[model samples]
Every structure is written in structure tokens, then in C-alpha cells.
Target chain A: MGGEFEGVVRPRRMRRSRRGQALVEFAVVLPLFLFCLLGALDAGLWAVQTSAEVSAVEQAAMVASSAGSSPTSETAPDAHAVLTSISGRLRSALFGTTIKSWCTTNASGDCAPDATQRCPTTPAEVQDVDGPRVVVVCVSEADPPACATPPPGQVAPYPPGCEDSPMITVRVVGFVASFVPPGFGPGASGFELPANISATTHTLRFAP
Target chain B: MRRRRRRGDDAQAVLETALVIPILLFLVCNFIAVMVQVTVQEQLNSATALAAQSRFQAPENAIDPSGTRCCGAPGMSLATAGLPTGCRYAAETFYGTMTTYTGLLHWLRATLCTSGGDSGNAAIPPMQPVAYAGSPSNAEVSCDIGSIKPGGTVIPGYVDRALNPPAGLNVVTCSASASLDFADTPLAWGVFWTPTLHAQAEALPPPFRQ
Candidate 1:
């Protein structure tokens, strides 16, 4: 017990304790570090998944807006069938198979945006919080054109072609489960940033 | 000497960890901001394009009657002033499709409706050109919509008579600009900068209707 080096030179036991203290600190910090990492991963995945769904829905809407798919008359191409392929491709990319298709036509059998017959029970509801992504495909015109002669949005009060043109809307709800916890990172209410897409196309001709 | 050196090393370790944590947090925030920007930009492109194309749905010479407004979000209508029925449709479609991330955007307003969209601003035809006839007061996105009259001498929104050939073909265009302000989001604490995103689109009249 030489008091000369009391403070400057510590016992080997003290040095060992210091090393142990470092180990303890690392142990405490490791889980927190790992948690932050996982949170980052969750956020990144969410962002990328959101981007994917956006691309998918927009593409589907574009297809529906294009000509030949719109029913100027019942004789025109079937809208449902035309959009199914595209929707299916969208499913392959992000959404699931069975896209909830909706239609609204006037009682007169003319297409309109008010049809709600085929709309799902909760059109905006996310069925499962953790699996099987739910996607909704809403069309201003019925797939087969209730009467082709009257395009969507055309009904009694308004003239035929003067009515609003057909439009297609695609929505992705509860896409990809949220990996983050209840209070970690940034998460939208439904675990995903729901994308609402409505696109329509109109044709024009040149004059001589 | 050894004990003092060890204390200095521990202090250094603590400092490094403190710095690393904040940097990682920043990376996460920036990544989210960039992703949001991309998504919004893409949606804007689609919306503007759809708006241009929707203008053609109205009659060739159709014009919005006096005191007309427009379609907005469901249950909500926008007072787009009297313009063209097609213009209203364009506004409706544009507003409807660009639905996500509205709160995060600080729009850079331009004339809501353009003659040939933003492209019509430049003189590029066999005649005089006008960019915007009028626009909605609070319109965010801008569109270029013009009609092809039966006996019109020169097209208003024509791109290039020489390049497009023959006489002229009308083209519709649209553009929207906005700054995605991330200062209000949850991740904003770590984010420092707000980025500006701009999207534009154009469409030609579909065939058969010709």
C-alpha cells in the first residue's frame, strides 16, 4: 500500500473493472444500435414499396384511359377485359390478383360515375393489416358498357357525348406490412401511403 | 500515464458514437424525402398529361358557358371560372389524380390553363401565340388546352407545322411545379433542406375521333 502512487497508479482490479464497464456500455448500446438499423430498413422498404404501387396504379389508369378501351357505344371493346390484363400485370408487380372492380351506370343503362353496385363493402378499408395486399379498381364506365350508345357520365339530364368521359381509378391500400413498431419511424395510418389514381383520355381530330 | 490515455480513448469513442447516430438519422430522413419527391413527381406527370388529353373530350369548338366553375375532389368543387368545358374536365382530372402528399407540397402556381400548356408560351408556329387565356385563382397545376376549329386559319397549340408536316396538328401540354417541404413531417427533425420538384406532360389527340 504505497500512498505515493495512490491516485496515479491504480490496482489491476480497477483496470479490469474499467474494461468491464466498457463491455457493459457496449452491451447497452448494441441493442439500441440494432433497433435503429432495423427501423431504417423498415422505412426504406416502405418508401420503395410505395413507389412500386404508385407506378402500378398509374400504369393501370393510363391503360384504361387509352382509346378502344372506352365504350363510346356498347359495340366498343369491353373495358373490363381490356383492363384485366393490365391489372393482372399490376398484381404481378405489387398488388394481388382479384382487383376489386366497381361500376356505376345510370338506370337507363348508360355508363356513369355514380354506379356503386360492384363496389366493395369498405372501398377504402384495408382488409388485412399484414398480408394479401388489397387493391381497388374503380371505373366510370361499366366493363361491357351498359349501353355503349351513352358513354359514362351521360344520362337523362345531360346530352350523350356532352357528358363526362369515362375514367379509371386505381387505389392501393395496406400494401406491404409495416415492419416498424407502434411508435417508431414514420408510418402512414394504414401502414402504406395509399395512392389514389384517376386518369381519363379524350380523342381529337385535325381539320383540313 | 496509461490510465489517462485510456480515459482519453473512451472519451473519443463517446464522441464518435454521438456523431454517428445523428448522421444515420439524417440519412433515413433524406431517403424518405427523396422517395416522396419521386412519387409526387411521377403522379404530377400522369395528372398533367391526363388533363391535356381530357380537353379533347368536349366538342371541337366547345367553350365553357358564362359563370362556370369546375370539378374538384369528390364532394368538393373548384371555382375555375368560365373557360371551356374541356378545361374544367382537365382541372378535375388533374386535381383528382394528384391526391397524395398535398400537405407536404408548397405549389409554385402558374396559369392554371395554358393554350398549349407551358410549351405554348414560346412562339413556334405559322401564327401568333398566346400562353394562357385565363386560370383558376387557386389552381396549382397548369395545363395547355386548345381546340382545332373546323375553319381555323392557324392552330393555337400547334407544335411545329414544319416538323409535324402537312398543315398542322394541335398538341395539348401541361406542367406543374412545387417544392416538397419536409419541414413539417415527423422525419423533419433530421432533415435540413427542402427540394423543389417539377413535372410536365403533353398529349396529342387520339385517332378515330379525327
Candidate 2:
């Protein structure tokens, strides 16, 4: 009976063997383990990207608010140069992507040309006018002051040959890539991860 | 006897696997849960800072650069060809008031939600108020922009708008609260405890400089 049982080769014994059991357990757990590990790595990358976006917006706001040495007319001057100069910083901070800029004199109404089009320019008369200036700076595919006619009797706050005035309205918008890899789940797709920050500050006054 | 021994061995192997699988899974899930929680917390912190900064940097429309009272019509004198051009100020009183009144709360909510964390969940508690140096009720005080320095100060009233006080001769106080649930796994005999984490931050306006 012992010889017959040995020759019969019970498959149950192999299943019970400790070495094979470890292999089976590993196979069962491996997919879940790998999923969690990859999820963590992706999440970490997302966090870093988020941090970078936050810092970029904050820095951009700071730069926009701080007064610069641009020559101005009687009306407030366009701070576009100062804004664009910081664009590179923001872009590099965001991993070397292109940064766009948009500026507008009107705030209540939609700035013409929208986010995708060039920023329309206030009429020459508006630029030459002495009034509050609204400057919208965003990252988009357009130029500022895109040659739009100003309302009758309203002049641009900053015109050529006007003395540089420091008062201006500055709006800044930044776009950063989403941290999720391409072709991820819904939560990760079609998100530009844009940051909109605005600040208004005048030239710093020194104590006499 | 041989057949009985083989059967016993198979039963032992099944028992061992049943025992090990749950523990291993528990460990893995716990690790994932902790990591997600940490990431959420970091995002929350970042949102808070951004929102606070946004509030501190009030919009131009919200402030009266000319130092006019809040009730007065909105407008600024323009600098024309070598002369000041008088222009009708658009009434942005609402804008100013909104910035002062809801700045902090707006920041708190926007920052929290913007980072992909849900505030409405039972697992997460709403932000709570913390007391700083001042009134004992300071723990839960909400001040308006009118109460602070007069409107149109050019500089917005609160340094960090997330802290509730819009403006004041006295200081403004703000509070925030949040909670998150930890992942759980079953044990041999019972279940492991789940954890809830919370955080809060406060800011005071710098004392008026001479």
C-alpha cells in the first residue's frame, strides 16, 4: 500500500509545499503591489508640479505688483515688459514650457480676442487719454493693445510721450501642465492646471 | 495513512496562505492610504498659502486709490496731456466690499477645493477657528472691512485674507479646519483602527508702522 501511494503522486502535496506556496502568494499580490507603487510615484510627481505652479503664480504676482522703471506717459505705463521678463522665470520654474502674455485696459467687459486670440489694443486716443488703466496679463497666443477702438471721449491712460505714471491695473494668468501622464483617467485628462492671480501695487514711496 | 498525510499537508498550505494574504494586503493598503493622505495635506497647505496671498493682494477696483469714502461714487482723476483729466469713477463699492468681507472665506474655500480635496465629506471636518492674542472670543470673531481702517486705503485691510477679519483698529482673526480618513484592513481577529488628521493656520496684520 505504501509503494502504491508513493507512485500515485498526490498533487495535493505539491500544492502544500512551502516553496510553491510563496510563489503563488507573490503572483497574487504582485499586481496590486505594483499598482500601489506606481500610483504613489505618479502622485508624488503631481505634488511637485502643483508646488511649482503655486510658487510660479506667487512669484509672478510679486513681480507684477512691484514697481518697475518703465518710462510712462501722463497715464500709467504698460508693465508688459516687466510681466514678460518674469514669464521666462515662470516657464523655467514650470519645466521649460512657453509662457504667453495678454494685457487689456478694460476690465468690466471681456478683453477682446479672448484667451486664444491676440489682446486687442486700446485706441490710440485711449492710450493717449488720462484715465485709469486696466492691464490684463495672461499666457495666450496674442499681442497686447490689438488695435481696438476706444469709446468716444475716453483716452488710453498710457500714451506715447506721456509722463510715466505708476498707477495701473495688473491681472496675471499662468498655465501649467497637469501632472498626470497622458492618457490617464478622467480626473487627470484635459486639465491645463491654470492659475489666475491679480495684484495692484504702486511704486514704492521712500520716506523723505 | 499516506493518503491522510497528503490531505493534511494540503490543508496546512491553504491555512498558511489565508493567514498571510490578509496581512500583506493590509500592509500594502495602509501604505497607499498614508501616502494619499500626505499628498492631500501638502496640496491643502499650498492652496491655503496661495489663497491667502491672493487676498492680501487685493484688486485695484476694490481699493479707493483717491482715499474717497466707500459711499462716494467710484472714479479716479486721469492724467491727460500735462493735466489731470477728471473721469467718472465706476461704482466698485461692491467689489471693494466683497474683497474685504469675503476675502478670507473665499480664499479658504477656493484654496481647499481647488487642490482636489472635498470639503463636504464626513471624513473631512470643516475648518475651525483658533484663538490668538486678543479677545477671548477672538477664537471665533469675524470683522468687516468697514470696521478696519476706512475703505480705499490703496492697501487692502487684511494681510492674509483667509483669517476672517476684513479690517479693524483691532486685529482680525481667522480659523480653518480639515479632516481625512485613513484606509483600513481586516485583521486575524478584528479590524485595525482608522485615523483622522487635521490642520489649522492663523495670520495677524503687521502693526501699523509709524
Candidate 3:
């Protein structure tokens, strides 16, 4: 009887020990596994958000530049009021959307310049850095309605027969906040993700 | 005794499953998110190119009847004293192309972003125009021939002597920029900052021989 009891008790003890060992191993590996999984998830999420930010800015900039949407509305009526409405619309669509006007210097100094006036020869000659800078001009409507001379740093090559014409320009910019988790991602100590997510655009102003 | 050992094995299996399943889920979700992002970016690029191309399609005579001859409508023309027919209304073209864009994901494109997105048709940020080139300076005409018409010669009538635009004039080019945000994600707790992505596209107007 003693031998029989000993056999049963010994097996039970062995089983208990094996189960305990497995539990210990699982506990030890679980945290590390969890960390890696979460990290990957974070990276993926960051990428998705980045793409979304870009999409948002592009859409906003295009709409702002297009004629059908140029700041003037039945409700807003006037240019300033239309501009105000535009600002509100952009802000609502994006986290922080700002419109920077790039215009030739006007008599009052940053209001829309005389349409026929030429752009300054150099960027440094520009008096107000606050006003948005003109990257390129399209002569969609010059007296001859052609393309403007390319600016200092203009990239797209000008087309032919397109003379300098009356034209409007629009610029849009928006910011995307960083996604790094504090003390975890690239900006653990407050460093931001290296990629610049600010999007800027230049387009022909559709509004006359 | 045998049953006792089997019970111990079952306990171990349960723990392993609990640990491994979540990791697998995390990885799978991440992969899906990344793929979605890539697709979105590609669509944006196509939209920009299409929009630029459409700008050139505006009938050469298309003009805002109310536009002033000097700057707005009836673009200044050397052929005539005032705004001429067949002049392009660039703003309208740009807006039309962008609003009708159907490249984006169905969910993303809730409405055409018209009127700076303030018209309440849909809520979306506007697309910004970044750069454009049309007509060439006399210097550029000689310096950058290929850029203007590829293989075409400068037409005698294309030159605007009054404006005195340099040679090799006549091409429409446009550049557009945009931004997007990821509004929701599963990693919110583990992430502190939201990510913003930016993209830009440039295109030359459809080629036209002067």
C-alpha cells in the first residue's frame, strides 16, 4: 500500500513541477513579445497617418487654388469674407491649415499687387518675407496671355506660345504632428520623427 | 498519474497560445496598414498628373466672360486688343479636374472638394497649386528647347512681342501639393504623436505642337 501511494504522489509532483516551469517561461517571454508587437503596431500606424496627412494637405491646397472654390461664396460675398470662410474651411479639414499669399508687391504693400507688375528679380529683394513667395507664374492670361518668365529656382520648364497673361497663384501649407511615443520611439527625449511632413503647394488661382 | 501529466500539458498550451496570438495579430494589422498607405500615395500622384493634364484641355478660347482683359478673363492677347476667344480659364480647369478626380479610395473621397471645401458638399482639405510654366523667355527658348515642345519648333504667332517673352514659348506645366492625416489607429495608447504625411506631384500639360 505504501508503494502504491508513493507512486501516485510522485507522478503528481512531477506534473506540477513541469507545469510550473512552462508558466515561468511564458511569463518571461510575454513582456518582450508584447513590446515588439506594440512597436511594430506603432510604426505601421505612424506610416498610415503620415500618408493621410499628405493626402489631406494636397486636397486642401488644390481646392483652395481652383476657381470654383476660390474663397468667394454666396454667403461670404466679399474677398476678405471669402478668405475668412476659406480659412475656416481649411482649418476644419486639416489640423492647422494656413494660406500664404504670394503676390507682386502692391502700393499698400502686401495686398494683391498690380496684376501686370513683374515679379521681383531676386527673392532677397522681396521686402516682406511674411508674404508667401512665388515659385512659378503661369501666363494663362497675359495681355498676350502667355507664361511668365521662370523664377530663380523654378523647376518646370516653360512651354511655348504661352505668353505672359493675367494669372493668379495660390499656395497652401499644413502641418502633421509627430507620432513618436515619448520615451519609446525616435523622440523618446522629445526628438521628432525625422521626416518632414509639412506639405506645400503652388497652383494657378482659378478665380478671376 | 497519466491524467495528471496530461492536465499539466494542457495548462502550458493555454499559456503559449495566449502569448503568441496577440503578437501575430499585431504583426498582421501593421502589414495591412502599411499597404493601405502605399496605395493612397500612388492614387495621389495619379490625381495630380491628371489634374495638370486637364488644365491644358481647357478650350484655348475658354475665358471667364467677366474676367478683365489685363489679368483675369479675356487674357491679354497679342492677336487682338482685348481678351480673345479660345483663351483658357485656368482656374476653372484646375477646379474641374480636381473635383472630378475619382482615383482616391471610396471612403476617402466623400465629396468633390469644391469651393475650398467650404461649400458643405464634402469636408476635405484643398489641393494647393505649387508651380506652373507656360510660354518661354527669349533666353529659355534658345537654352531649353526640349523642355518647351520636345521636338516642335517655335511658332511665329506664338511669340508675344509686347511682353517680349523669350523664344521656345508654349507649354503648360503644373505642380500640386497636398497633406493627409491618419485620424484613427489601434496604437493610440502606445503612440504619443500623430503622424502627418505630405506628397507633391508635378506634370507638364499635354504636349501641343505650336
Interface RMSD of 3: 9.9
Candidate 2 runs further than 4 Å off: A1-23, A61-208, B1-33, B50-175, B181-210
How far off is residue A69 in model 3, in Å? 10
lDDT of 2 by residue, A1-208 (tens): 9877866655556545756867876887787666556655544544464444434444443344332322331222233554555555455545533444454535643344334433223312222332112223442221223334456675654342122213233343343444445455354223333433332222211111
DockQ of candidate 1 relative to the true structure: 0.28
> In model 3, how large is the Cα lDDT of residue B46?
37
- Candidate 2 vs candidate 3: the TM-score winner is 2
Cα RMSD (angstroms) for every candidate in the order listed: 8.4, 15.9, 17.0
Q: For model 1, what share of native contacts is present?
A: 0.35
Leading candidate by DockQ: 1
lDDT digits (tens) for residues A62-86 of candidate 1: 5555544343532222335435645
State the TM-score for model 1.
0.65
Q: Find the candidate with the highest lDDT and give its number.
A: 1
User: Residue by residue across A38-126, what tens digits does model 3's lDDT show?
Assistant: 65654565455444434543444343333332434211121232233344444443332233333443565443524464433332233
Q: Weakest 10 consecutive residues, lDDT, candidate 1 chain B?
A: B66-75
The models' CA-based lDDT, in order, is 0.52, 0.34, 0.35
Native contacts retained, all candidates in order? 0.35, 0.07, 0.00
